[model samples]
Structure formats: C-alpha cells, structure tokens
Target: MKATTMKTLTVSLTPHQAAMMQGAVESGGYASNSEIVRDALRLWEQREEIRQMELARLKRAYDEGMASGEGREVSADTLLKELKAEARSSG
Candidate 1:
C-alpha cells in the first residue's frame, strides 16, 4: 500500500456549523472533526460530479433536438387547438 501525505487546513465556520461538527463527534458517529469535514467533502464532490454529468446530458439532448428538424414558433392556443383537432380526428 502507498502512503498518502496529509495536509492540514484551517477553516473558519459559523457557530452553528461548529456546533454541528462538535455534536457529530460527541454522538460517537465520527472520531473527530476532521472525519466529519472529510465525509462532507466527499459528499460535496459527488454532488458536483453528478451536477456536471447532468449538465452534459442536457447539452447533448438539446443538440440532438436542435438537429432533429427545423424549429417553428406556435402560440399556446394554436398548439392546443391543433392537438384537439388531431385527437378528434384520430378518435
């Protein structure tokens, strides 16, 4: 196993945030404040990765939609009327 070098960082937090971390340690769920901060960072990193992936997926979908056909402008009323007509005819 490879040894990883750890760096110490100083972070300033609000009283509420500080209390929350202290509570977690007191609850025995976490060994120390560092563990809580590391866990929170891991969750934050995961959420950021997911957000980037979703944005990329949306971009691809948008590109595909734009490439599918020519765009047309239609009012809500016109669209509703057209849809109703089509439904009536199909029925």
Candidate 2:
C-alpha cells in the first residue's frame, strides 16, 4: 500500500452547516467532520466530471451539424405535406 500525506486546513461554516456536520458524526453515519467533507468533495468532483463530459458531447454534436453544410429554408405546409406523403409511401 502507498502511504498518503495529509494536509490540514481551517474552514469556516455557517451555524446550520456546522450543526449538520456534527449531527452526521453523532449519527454514526460518518466517523468525523473531515470524513464528511472528503465524501462531499468526492461527490462534487464526480458531478464536475460528468458536466465536462456533457459539454464535450454537445460541442462535438454542434461541430458535426456545422460540417454537414448550410441548411435550406422550407415552408411548414410544404414540409408537412412532403413528410405525410413519404410516411404514407413507406407505410
């Protein structure tokens, strides 16, 4: 097993937040406030990673759409009629 170095930092929290952390420890759900903070940080990191992936996927889609070429304007009635005709033929 690899040995990990730990660093300590002071953090200030609101009264409600402090009570919530303390309650979590008292409830036996967490061993200490630091553990709760570490767990919360892990969740936050996961969420950030997912958000980044979604942004990249959207960017790729936008690039593909732009590469497909310019779009033409079509009238709604004409488009609808054409769609209905195609559907009828396919069906």
Candidate 3:
C-alpha cells in the first residue's frame, strides 16, 4: 500500500513530553512525530468512547432502579448474600 501524504502541524508540550515524543520518533518505529501523536490521539479517542458507553450504561441502570420503586432497605446480611450470589455467577 502507498504511504499516506504528510502534513505539518505545530503543538506545544512540556519539556519532558517533548523528550518522550522525540525518543519515540528516534526509535525508528514511527515515521515522524505526527505519526506518534496521531496514534496516541486515536487511542485516547477510543478510550473516551468506552468511558462514555460505560457512563450511559450506569445511567440506564440507575434510572431503571429508580423507576422500579423498590423501597430502600439496608439489611447487611441480605446485601452480603445478594452480592455473593452475583459474584459467584459472574466469576
């Protein structure tokens, strides 16, 4: 496959970060500094997406529990038994 065309971009970073990026580029695994930045940005974007999905799942569960109108009862034994059952099933 043909390699992609390169473009110039300017960014600011701390000295340590710059050193790390320069080291990565000098390792010869990345074609340029831009390649390293692009890879990191892609990974960050993917992780952000996963975080958003998890947040949405938690929100849905909370809303469902609220809608169920279950009275709040904090019996420690009951909670422990239910938690153990769930852990057993999951693990």
In the range 1-91, model 3's lDDT, one tens digit per residue, is 9998877878999999989888988988788888889999999999999999999999999999899997787799999999999999999
Overall lDDT per candidate, in order of appearance: 0.97, 0.97, 0.91
- Top TM-score prediction, candidate number: 1
Candidate 2 versus the native: TM-score?
0.79
Candidate 2 lDDT (Cα, whole model)?
A: 0.97
- Give one digit per residue, the lDDT tens place, for model 1 in 1-91: 9998989999999999999999999999999999999999999999999999999999999999999999899999999999999999999
Error of 3 at 80 (Å): 2.3
**Per-candidate TM vs. native?**
0.81, 0.79, 0.73
Off by over 4 Å in 3: 1-9, 81-91
User: Judged by TM-score relative to the true structure, which candidate is superior, 2 or 3?
Assistant: 2
The worst-scoring run of ten residues by lDDT in candidate 2 lies at 4-13
Q: How well does candidate 3 match the true structure in TM-score terms? A: 0.73
Residues 1-91 of candidate 2 have per-residue lDDT tens digits of: 9998989999999999999999999999999999999999999999999999999999999999999999889999999999999999999
